[model samples]
Target chain A: MSAPLFEKIALVGIGLIGSSLARVIRRERLAGEIAIATRSPATLARAEELGLGDSYSTEAATAVANADLVIVSVPVGSSGAVAAEIAPALKPGAIVTDVGSTKRSVIAQMQPLLPGNVHFIPGHPLAGTEKSGPDAGFADLFENRWCIFTPLPDTDPQALERLSEFWRRCGANIDTMDADHHDMVLAIVSHLPHIIAYNIVGTADDLETVTKSEVIKYSASGFRDFTRLAASDPTMWRDVCLHNKDAILEMLARFSEDLASLQRAIRWGDGEKLFDMFTRTRAVRRSIIDAGQEIDVPDFGRQVVEHPGAVMPAAKS
Target chain B: MSAPLFEKIALVGIGLIGSSLARVIRRERLAGEIAIATRSPATLARAEELGLGDSYSTEAATAVANADLVIVSVPVGSSGAVAAEIAPALKPGAIVTDVGSTKRSVIAQMQPLLPGNVHFIPGHPLAGTEKSGPDAGFADLFENRWCIFTPLPDTDPQALERLSEFWRRCGANIDTMDADHHDMVLAIVSHLPHIIAYNIVGTADDLETVTKSEVIKYSASGFRDFTRLAASDPTMWRDVCLHNKDAILEMLARFSEDLASLQRAIRWGDGEKLFDMFTRTRAVRRSIIDAGQEIDVPDFGRQVVEHPGAVMPAAKS
Candidate 1:
């Protein structure tokens, strides 16, 4: 299929993103050979058992050897260690990148350790589900999604273009922004939402007045939506909160301030203010739908999707 | 199907819930006649055009006259006014019930205004989407959902049983709790989540560092989930906020307190604490899935649901 893009590609930390990349690359024939690596022997063994790669190893250095393209998909907190482990074996002129959620922290952690001969273009793919690990990934995980690259000022244009083409072939559109701006953007969109979700679920769990069984029973109302985000990989999220501390803290402060104002409105019975705020936020969802970032169906199409052949409301009569 | 549950059933509001009730009642042949009423002439006209009822009126009193059963499905704030208007017109021995989020408020507003000859019961169906209005309803909206009834202590048992049967035929399981307990339960499960969603969306919208467009574009990462709840009907949510102020504020206070502690953990880079909280929340989602309250698919099955032929990751290689 249009010739392999790279002779050899190495994927480090074969979790959801890494395994999905392996599947998509194989499907598109993007790489002539695939090498997989993770710190855990069990995960590496699972990857080999699933036939995800031509070669598998628990040693990151071994996987990076002779690889023309290397992707690091470890937790943000482990970026430095992975970079240190793989730097000595990376082939000359190989293009290296990552799918970390936080750009600045990852760049800060990896840039100095990576050999200057390799092109280290920092990236964050704005795609994924609440689930993680090798088995949770799907070949089309990046379909119609955005894969943002935060390239350094002195980065090579040719290497950046090649990486962009690679992501495009994997079914993701590309955007390039400065690393700080990327962190700030992701802090609000990804990090803050996950943190808030985890906190709210914790709050619901700690309730003495309402039983856990009751919360679980009636969660279809709205609380269940947060549970998906809350159920994400704890190690990954813990790393995110630790790595992107400033931006996340800033967004959290703003969120708390706004929540205080909303609490006050409820306390004062300010229907007008509550209505105005609720109405304004509705337009945001509409904009997201128009932008093709979300499904147009109600409740994310859960009812119809979960129960195929269920009667459509309009057709019931 | 079976013999009609009532000779005539009156609906005093024609919004999403009311219209859905009309459609379901017609589908099951649960009523000999369906009378629909709404304060908005436009909505009433639309309901008639949709063929959702046997008769339509702008006057709640006219709609309830001579009806064997009456269901009030209006914003919580309008419950008292509708109760007052229809009390004189309700047939003797008629079962009158309301579907409001806050049970105590609806009981307070409707109980004293009703005649002693009629049976007054309060109910809340825990089903709906972010959509509203007459056209946004379907017959199956209540299927497999919870329809909670908070009957007054002195309520007629036979009437309550009949009402329970009606909701069951409409495709909902029934639960009964005290008015105060129902409010508290819903405050944590429903009201708090909506308020948090509205607040978070407002916070993101007001951000200066992160543009609104950026937020919308990257929303799939996590922010979009909150927007669905934020996109719910404004008047309904506002009324819920005002009418259920005490329970909502109490839940909101607990949420904020929990959030503050989570914030401290992040600010201090307490990875152990963050990971523990995140891990603990994962089990709650599992409990929800195990209870058959949620779908087992990852990402709420959005990827496959939105694009039917998309490759499953396991099938790709």
Candidate 2:
């Protein structure tokens, strides 16, 4: 590359999102030097062992000093703390951003702390697996994903475009919406799914008649799909639920009401109503697959061997 | 291979499960001849085109005339009608079984119609993908999966052994339980998950504030996993809910109660409660992955290269 995008980039709280950003940035030569920082000393040591950055520090202020860009990638609840820590050390023209899931609360928490000289654009990458930690991240985590920016009204256009280009280089498509709309949209799309998955798995776990082993053995029937979402980082999800309370509660209320209606249809033996809802939902999945939002890998095992073989794979797990 | 397990096998209802069973039977040399039948002429034609069986017919009686094994794979609501049509033609020693998701209802609907001369073992293979129809089937769908049998009190031991042997040959582990117990177990494991998935997807579809396109585009953010389970055949699920009403309603009520508590936790900003629930649920996914009951495929796009590359891929879908 002729020159790196920034002379130095400071990453705060190097967890899954943070480390993934580091990998993509290094892969694309997006920064001349990478500075990593986290609250935990053990995590900072792990980042160093992973060769994640050009410099490692346990102190956020030490990491952000003289850096052109600072990205806070901790849980949403920690946004304000990091912003306050790095505010005095931020360079005059540095652009400060975050990769939190909830936008409105993050904006409310962090905006008041950052100085007027820096651009504080709240963002969320509509990406990630349920797995977490530094090891769980990879350079392509954001590939073909959406990164939504909820820029405050006073945000600098040039700074916003610059951040957008950075995410684009990191293999994500970018969009912009206000903080409130972002929270509402995400409550239905992301928050509700995780809550439902966690709830169902917990319910299954607590069943006295149906042993836990039984649930685990027959999970592939339908229960296993929810488990993946339920296995997400607990701390991150707790923060999202706490920060986006109103929007999530709104979505959960609607979800519970819809489920009540479905339960009534089943109790009353209304096959027509049940069939209609199930049929309508199938169309949405088709649209998601058609929109290229899903992998469409075919959940069942692939039948290989064109001519002849055992229907089952030869090797058992 | 060793003198086919049975002289001939007849499959009624050539959908995903039926086609998959036919493929597995042929691969394992479990039958000398295969006969397929369905109420829909188009489905029978498609099954014939796919070479799913040696013979095809629209009449269930004709298909089961000389068959040693008769598998009814139709929707649960149609179980009684199929049993009535084939009861007269079933061979004296033939084993008649079903693969319906609900056990008690299938037994109740089919048992009285059939003669005591033939064995009626109600069975369900805990396997399937969301897609339906003959074209969507693969032989390996039931590999390492559970095939549960709900046998009547007077069912012949030899007939049960023969059918169990056939399922083992098809690469499934088998277990037997009473019909009522099977229904209750399945209501929590299979029926509830599908209902919740269908309900959430329906809620998303009916939302006026959040556009459908937005949900579809950002579905990789966790919602797409639910969509896979929700997209299952509508006719099949409608029958399941109607047939397993009491058990399903019980599980749904428990699920709703757990969800309401979770909603309150989020509303009251009880991060500790949220964290505890989210953490406990993660262990269940671990058990599922360990039990070899699920393929723990990571959800996001994999990181293909480690070094460096352009943000955009060469191929665009």
Candidate 3:
């Protein structure tokens, strides 16, 4: 491993992203001494049992004490509390950052509480699965994924580059953007999709005419795709909805308007209109696949059922 | 190969589902002879090149002339036209079936046209990927997947059993249900999900607020899941929406209502309500996984980027 990037690095949350960060830090030797802290004792003990850090504590302030860098990976809603708790304990010239879905709200919550001598940069890693908790994390979670920083205007350039270098060591490509712009981009790509998935799955469950068992049995057809996103962490998503309220509502309104028009087309037996919309959206998936955001699966990458007597090359997803 | 189950089997409209059926039948030696037909001459030529059949034709009538079993696998909207074209050529005691998502409409369209001497059975396999056309199919597409039949009340029991046996030989589990019930169940499990996916992807694409490139780049966070469903065969999905208008509309309405409440919760900053909704949806995903319809993946079976220092066995999806 290369020389340590920071003398001491504090991770203020030990859930999926936090634990993944800790794993990557240890793997790449990014920190000389790693400090892990979480509110729950069981989770802190689990982190210790996993040997993810050199030091551990339940108090956020204790974890950040004398740390050259502190990374907060909590739900966006708790940013203010964590910031207030750790503010007084942060070392001067320390680089403080967060991994939260929404950027603007996080900045609003943390910027005032953070000491003036410290660097406050807001960041979000555009990678994750539906899983949560420390055990759900893995070492390569951020590999080849984008980690975006919504740095404040007054942020130190050297501190930003140092953090960027740290994320680069964790195998992520980095991009910087304004906080409001980051929030809007994330609202469409992340927050709205989760809300919509949750809503549709809930609707399917509450159907009076169709039994839940049938829905569960045949979900492979389409509905199961939505469930993956719907199964994401409840607290994190709840916080996302509450913090990213305006942008999420805007996306929801547009999505519903588009859906109503689609409904009308179906109602009128407008096959041509339906076909056009269906066909148009296909190009978007192709673009995403072309850009490497999606895997190149001929199907939805259901490799288990694909080894049949067909002439096409097997896509062993 | 095993002994042929039928003297001959005819497949019309050689797209993903139809071609998969052809591959399975040929692999299992389910038919003495295979006759493939499609409206498109180019598609017929491609199927011939792929060795998907013993005989190829552009005429559905000619393909089914002396066949003991004919599986019409066209778009749902074309069910009536196909029935009208092949009605006179069907032999007495022959079994007729169509694999369509909307059973009631397919039955309503084909029943009146088919000869009374022929047994008309409606079947839908609850399996498919986003891929379409002959080249996208494989032999094991139906393996361990459900194939539901909405048979006519006056249908011959022996013919239904024979058709069911053919599917069983193709590695499918079979069930019988009312056509109306099949339509309603499928509206939730299949149709609405596709529609919602199409709508969301379309909305993201049409956004003046967010660039298309940005959406594509960040899609992995959540939007990419919906893109898979939206990338499904347009002609077939269009037909599904048009054919199952009532059920699709009903499901859309319910989905929209639930989504409205979710939007309200976000707008009003109702954290508890949002948390409850998000938490409840996770159980639906668990049930789907437990029922063996979905894999137990933290994500949508994406095994890559999961090497985050965990000891869990690799999910090589």
Candidate 4:
């Protein structure tokens, strides 16, 4: 095996992403000493029980002391608080980073709190499941996924490269973009989708005619997919919405406008328009499959991923 | 192995569901002979290539002739045509059924044309994937899923019991509901979700600010879930919308009303309302998990079905 990437790595906020990183780092022997910290005493105890780190503490400041690298995997809204808590204790030249979905907000919240001696790079690993908490993490969570970093101007390039290599070892391909661009992109792709999922699921729950049993019974059709996303960590998503407000609202506005148009088409029975839009979206799924972003399901549950191209339908025009 | 349930079974329209039934029938020895037919010669040839049946034909009449049981699994729009085509050829006392998403319409379109001598029981196997065509099918597709049959008033109880047993051997529990109730239940659980997914994916595809590459790059958040549903069979879905117009429109109206309320909450920053709705929906997912309807994800890629009550979250008040 290759040499350990750092002598010590401190992971603040031992949630899904953090614990997953901890598991992968331990499995790969990428860090000599692992320090885990979270605000909740129960969660901290759970992390200790899982043996996810060499050291565990409820104090963020204590966890980052003398660590060569510190990863703050808290919600975007909590980034500033965690950064403030650990700033006085961070070792000089320590590469400080975060794994928040919204990049710009996290950078805005965290960058000002960290000491100038430490490198503050905002990163988001484009991977996760609907599950949350320490026990919800696994070593292979980042495999074949993208880890994007948004570095500020005047940032140390070497530190950036080192962090990139760190994520690569954790089984993620690295990409860099400006923080604002990352927020806008994620708003369209991730945040908006979660918001819509939560909305639709809420809609189903509020229905007067449709019972919950019926929804669960017939969910194999399409509702089940949204349920998985809607079932995500509520606290994390609530923080995401509040932190990435502008971008999410913008995306939501655009989505509403497009939905209005679709509603019009459906009301008018414009099959051609519906067919055209539906046909175009099929290609994006193909592109994602080609990019290895998702598993190809011939039928969602029946056909396993035996052959790559065999599972997806032929790309429709 | 058990004795064949039917002397000969004819599947008229060998697509995803049809071919899956064919495979399951063969695997369980449910039929002594299988005849597959579709309007498209190419699909028929493909079904033949997959060895989905003992006989393959493009003519529906030819396929159903002399068959003890005939299952018409086609797009909802084609039910009338298929019914007319096969009506004269059906054997006396044969059991005929369909596996269509929209049952009321299928019954409305098909029942009059089918020979009265045959027991015309319309059914909907509430299972499917985004993928279609003969190659997308497997023998285990219906395992542990629900199959709802909306039998006509004059339908024979013996024929109904026999069909229920057949579905049981194919790994499904059967429920009987009126066609209208089935349509209403599915409208909320299935149709609305598909429509919403198609709408969101189309919205993302048409975005001017968020580039296509950006959507694909960061889709792991929640948008990717919608993409799977959006990538469903367009022809089949289009027919569903047209046939089940009233139910779908009613459900869509409810969804839009709830969405408007959600949008207002977001706009007004009503955290309490948002939290309440989000919290309530989380319980629904827990119930679904408890009912053995979903797989638990440690992370998104790694999925396993947990034992009942193993992963149940705390119930929301």
> How do the predictions measure up, each by TM-score?
0.96, 0.96, 0.95, 0.92
Q: Which candidate wins on DockQ?
A: 2
Higher-ranked by DockQ: 1 or 4: 1
After TM-score superposition, the amount by which residue A300's alpha carbon in candidate 4 deviates from its true location, in angstroms, is 5.0
- Model 3 per-residue lDDT at A113: 88
lDDT of 2 by residue, A32-76 (tens): 999999989898899999999999999999999999999999999
Q: Per-residue alpha-carbon lDDT of model 2 for B1-317, expressed as tens digits? A: 36999999999999999999999999989999999999899999999999999999999999999999999999999999999999999999899999999998898899999998898999999988898999877788888889999988898899999999999888888988888888888988899999999999998998998999889888889888899889999999999999999999999989999999999899888899999999999999888877777545456222222212212233222
Q: What is the C-alpha lDDT of each candidate?
A: 0.90, 0.88, 0.88, 0.83
The recovered share of true contacts, given per candidate in order, is 0.73, 0.71, 0.76, 0.45
lDDT of 3 by residue, B1-317 (tens): 55689999999889998999999998898999999999999999999999999999999999999999999999888999999999999888888899999999998899998888898999998888898899988998887678999887897889999999999888888889999999999999999999999999999999998999899888889999999989999989988998889998889889988888888888888999989989999999888766666656556445453322212322111
For each candidate, how many residue pairs have backbone atoms clashing (under 3 Å)?
Answer: 1, 0, 6, 1
Q: Highest lDDT, which number? A: 1
Report each candidate's C-alpha RMSD, comma-separated, in the order given: 3.7, 3.6, 4.5, 6.4
Those runs of model 1 whose alpha carbons end farther than 4 Å from true positions after fitting are A305-317, B305-317
lDDT tens per residue, model 1, B194-278: 9899989999999998899899888989998899999999999999999999999899889999989999999998999999999
User: Residues A176-233, candidate 4, lDDT per residue (tens digit)?
Assistant: 8898888888888888888888888888887777687888766767787787778888
Q: Which ten residues in a row have the lowest lDDT in candidate 3 chain B?
A: B308-317
Give the TM-score (0 to 1) of chain B in model 1. 0.95
Name the lDDT value of residue B110 in candidate 4.
Answer: 91
Instruction: Report the lDDT tens digits of candidate 3 across residue range A171-232.
Output: 88899999888999999999999999999999998988889888987887899899989999
lDDT of 4 at B83: 94
Q: Regarding DockQ, does 2 or 4 come out ahead? A: 2
TM-score of chain A of each: 0.96, 0.95, 0.95, 0.94
